[model samples]
Target: MSAALGLLAVIVLTAATGYFVAQEFAYVAADRAALEQAAARGDASARRAAKVIGRLSFMLSGAQLGITMTTLVVGFIAKPALAGLIQPLLDAAGIPEGATGAIALAAGFVLATLIQMLLGELFPKNLALARAESLARALASSTLVYLTVAGPLIRLFDRAATRLLRTVGVEPVEELHSGATLEELGDIIGKSQSSGHLPADLSGLLDRALSFGDLTADEVMVPRPQVSTLPSTAPAADLVALIRETGHSAYPVYDGEVDDVIGVAGVREVADDALDPATPVGRIARPALLVPGSQPLYGVIERMRESGEEFACVVDEYGGLAGILTFEDVAEELVGEIADETDAREDAPTTGPDGSWLVDAGMRIDEVVRLTGLDLPEGDAYDTLGGLVMAELRRLPCPGDRLTVALDGASGHGEPDGASGHAELEVVSVARRVAEKIRIRTAAAPAPADRPEISDPPCAAPRPEEASWTR
Candidate 1:
């Protein structure tokens, strides 16, 4: 009976070890998937599943270690009894008595390893992967109990491991439970949406939320041309009148052109100060925080949070004013378009006939690229369509000038017709001679070819820049 109990103990230890291993690995996979889904705009279910799996994973790790240690101790303690039980079998098989103990020990160890590796580790892990949500939910409570019981021991082990790792010139693995990165979370959300585990709108909202990290101040800022400002020389009464007419909370104060902006004035301050009517706008203005157009929106948000500033002036590399970015701009990127009580303008500056829109002349190129699905090149030098056009052309183009824009294939090759797709840029229009503004018109070109092929131009001269701004 003692021998039988020893054998039973070994079996239980092996099984527990396997179970913990499988649980740990499976939870890792599930957590990774969940994080990706969250980033991709996945539904709450995926995120919840991920969270449960992550918590359970740590518990599983502790359980595995405990079970392994316990198994070693128990097996060592039971070795003599287990060996005695196997002696009879070895004798019956005509094995030497001297070798019986060694044979029995080897056989028992092999059996335990096999059972742990297969039944405990592999099978449970496969099951968990197949139905992660269900498995995670079911295992959560038990795992928590294990974690609570083993917390102190786990911490001690972790600290030791960390020190050992540092001694070996390796960084300690950060505790795995922190959470998933934005991109990884996005992928999981995308998968959930594809699997019909989440609703479309909610998934889309989540994706947009993740995108807030990638957005920049330039992409969301109100362009310089679109900003309403008070001249520094303007009287306080005139500044107040302009603010009332525009219904804006704040206005940039400029000495000359908008590019020469000195600071920002808040309507509330104007009301509170009740400054003399002849007071210079600069006298009422507050110092402005200036940010580069290339600054990421996330960084801008952090800056706003740390500085307690509400407005930032975006500028180009030339130190010229580019636009104005507000806290609301960053907020809108995370939560979608936010129209406030004071935003009375019905028509945006750059609407198209089919509802496809042009970014305002002053709008940041990054924002246009995000909203319009345009593939703009990356660089710090330019942040608007006008700037991009000017860079590419090298010279200011006349109304009838034509230029070719190339679209690289998927493999980044100039394939006009091949498996990848055609590469070509057709001239749509050019700058209006008098106004110095380019009026681009859209025209249907042949579908991109898989291999290189050039189509003949129908027009003798490039189409003239259209006079109307609407299209």
Candidate 2:
């Protein structure tokens, strides 16, 4: 009867050990955000779980206490009883008396350790991790009861631990949790994309947002020369016409020069019934928000929000208007281009005669490589094809400027015979003293001898198309 009682006590204590193990893991691994959301929607279980999680240190202490006590009780009750049960079996096997007792004790200890580790620790720990949220909610009530029963002991332990931590230069009040840093978040997004758990576009947007804080306003702004402006002294009628022609909602009104921009005038505000059409734009224009070119994009956005202005003029170190950034520009950096009715998009790269291509000056180097399948050098020296050309030549390219260099591989189909090639810059149009449109010509690749020859299409004559480009 005494041995039966000891076996029952061992079973109960082992079960308690497993329960505490599950409780500890479930609470720690559960998503706090998910718990909070459930609590907000009036889930009693989630509310209780969150309450326990709030004092995570104390809750962990309670779990440790329970696990330790239960393990100790099981060890004391089961070891002697199992050894006694095994001793008779060893003796029946004809083992000598002295060796039989030692062998029985060793065998029982090994068996007990294996059972305890498997059932009371590893199995419960894995289950909690796999179904952290559900297990956390299911165990919340029992965990609370355990805490109530051991409240005083847990509090005493917590106080001692906190005091010891404080002595080691640690803040006891700060929550102990692992947080994802920007780099780690980026890696997670990358992995999610690769695993098909996230869409590529969504992954890209998340990555952009993660790095948004590191960007500056100037990187996304329209350069000074590209910003359209109206004279502060211009008549309201002219302002209306400019607005219609530009299709821009706002324009900076300058005192005398672009650098002297004094205010911003919205076309809608000017067209209001309270305003006079004959009035000078400067009289009705709103004061312009001036921001440094070096200001972080996030801070600029906050400033825009607080000031209730969607546009700002970025000033350089010398107090000159460096560029202009609108709310849409900053937002685009985070979420990508927000197209509207005014957007004129080209669906494909223009093919030129003699197996060449006509690309815009603003075409990015990466886009060029992607479309043309040409491996061009990428560096900080230039971002666009036009910029690359200028940097190579050390001068602004004219309509006839030409340069030849070896490509990583031969240009496909329309390029000249050799792996090497030349790019002739045919300036189609100019804007803001730069080539806005350029026609690139390369030597045609020779057709295979076995394949029938295909005729090269005639070059499309360049039409005069030059205007301010907005992205």
Candidate 3:
């Protein structure tokens, strides 16, 4: 009867141990962001869990105390009770009385430990970690009750631990953390994308949003050459033509040159008044936002928002008009392309005959590499395909110029599977003294560069001043 009573007590203690173990693991692994999101959506359980997670150090100490105490009590009761049950079996197996008791006791200890370690520790811990958020919500209320009962002892232990740490020159404080680091979050997104839990487009957007802080205005801006501008002293007819040709809502009004500009004129604002052919373009211009090219995109966006201006002229180190960026550009960096009715897709890449691709020189090198499935080369010295070709030719590229180069690498969109190939790049058109349209002819597979050739004698390397802004 006593042994049976002792066994019941041991089972109860083991259950308590399991509770604490589960509570510890669940909260440790729980996604706090998910909890907060749930709370925002009016989940009562999630709110309670968030509270406990907020005071993680205290809650954790309570869990540890409960686990330790329950384990100790279970061990004390289990050995004697289990030994009593084992002794008779040992004797019936013809073991001698003196040796039988000792062996029975040892066996009892091993059995109790195995049962406790498996049922009380490992099982619940695994269960909690696998379903962390759900388990945390379920356990939070009960844990709070436990902490209320054992608050004094938990605090005492925590204080002692803090003092011990201070003695060793370490400051002890509550170690509660709520969110994953950027790198960890990125890794999670990558894994989710690979496992098909997240769509590729959504994953890419999320990754870009997280990385927006690292981008500079220069990286996302439209270079100066791509922007249309009108001389501030020009007639209103010029403004009308500029808007009609570029299909832009706004254009910079420069005094003499693009660098000596005054302000931006919106077509709608300019058109609001009666059209006078002789009206100076500067008469309708609004103040243009000037920002440094090196400014981080986040700060640029904030500055634009605070100033109530969407268009900014990005200036380089020497204060030259480096480029222009709009709110749409920064937004596109976060959420991918924001297409509109006015967007000209005619210049976009297209499929050509015989495994050839029609590409735009304005396309980013990384993007071109992705689309062509050919290992087009790249270096930090250039960013656009046009720039790369120009650097190689060492001169102004003209229509009909062709170059045969070995394909070596591809990146960003994960194309070509790191294969090598040879490609013929034929210039189809030139605009603004740069290659505007390029035809890329790709072979089926990677091959060694055997017969390198070029058509039209290449020019000498351009002067730094000429290539700096042109390419």
Best by TM-score: 3
lDDT string for model 1 (1-471, tens) is 488787787667666765565556556655566454763685554454455555553555586686678667555745655666777899899998789879988776666556555766677778767866556545555566677788888878877877998999998545465567887988888788778898877876787787777777777888776788888888888877887787777888888877888988877567765468788888879887888878888888778778788889898888888888887877776665667777643444453564334333333544444444344454566656556555555544333333333322222111122212211222234433211333333223434322221243322333544433421
Residue-pair clashes per candidate, as listed? 25, 5, 1
lDDT of each: 0.62, 0.75, 0.79
Clashing pairs in 2: 415-443, 415-444, 415-445, 416-443, 416-444
Error of model 1, residue 298, in angstroms: 5.1
Which regions of candidate 1 are displaced past 4 Å? 1-122, 130-178, 198-205, 213-219, 236-247, 256-262, 269-280, 283-309, 315-320, 339-369, 372-376, 397-471
Q: After superposing candidate 2, which stretches have Cα over 4 Å from the reference? A: 1-5, 36-43, 178-188, 233-245, 269-286, 296-308, 348-471
- Quote each prediction's TM-score: 0.54, 0.69, 0.76
| Winner on TM-score (1 vs 3) | 3
In model 3, which range of ten residues has the least summed lDDT?
A: 462-471
Global fold similarity of model 1 (TM-score): 0.54
Pairs in clash, predicted candidate 3: 420-446
lDDT of 2 by residue, 1-471 (tens): 365676677777788899999999999999988998999999999999998888787788899999998888777777776777788888999999989878877887876787679888899999999999999999999899989999999888888888999999997764666578888997898788778899978977787788788777766687787788889888888888887887888888899888898999976667787767788999888999999988998889889999999999999888889889998887777776677776566444445455566677776664465445455555676667778666665655454445543455532212333323434445655555466676655534422222111243322343456422322
> Cα deviation in Å at residue 232, candidate 3?
2.9
Give all candidate RMSDs, comma-separated. Answer: 10.0, 9.3, 6.0
For candidate 3, the per-residue lDDT at 378 reads 72
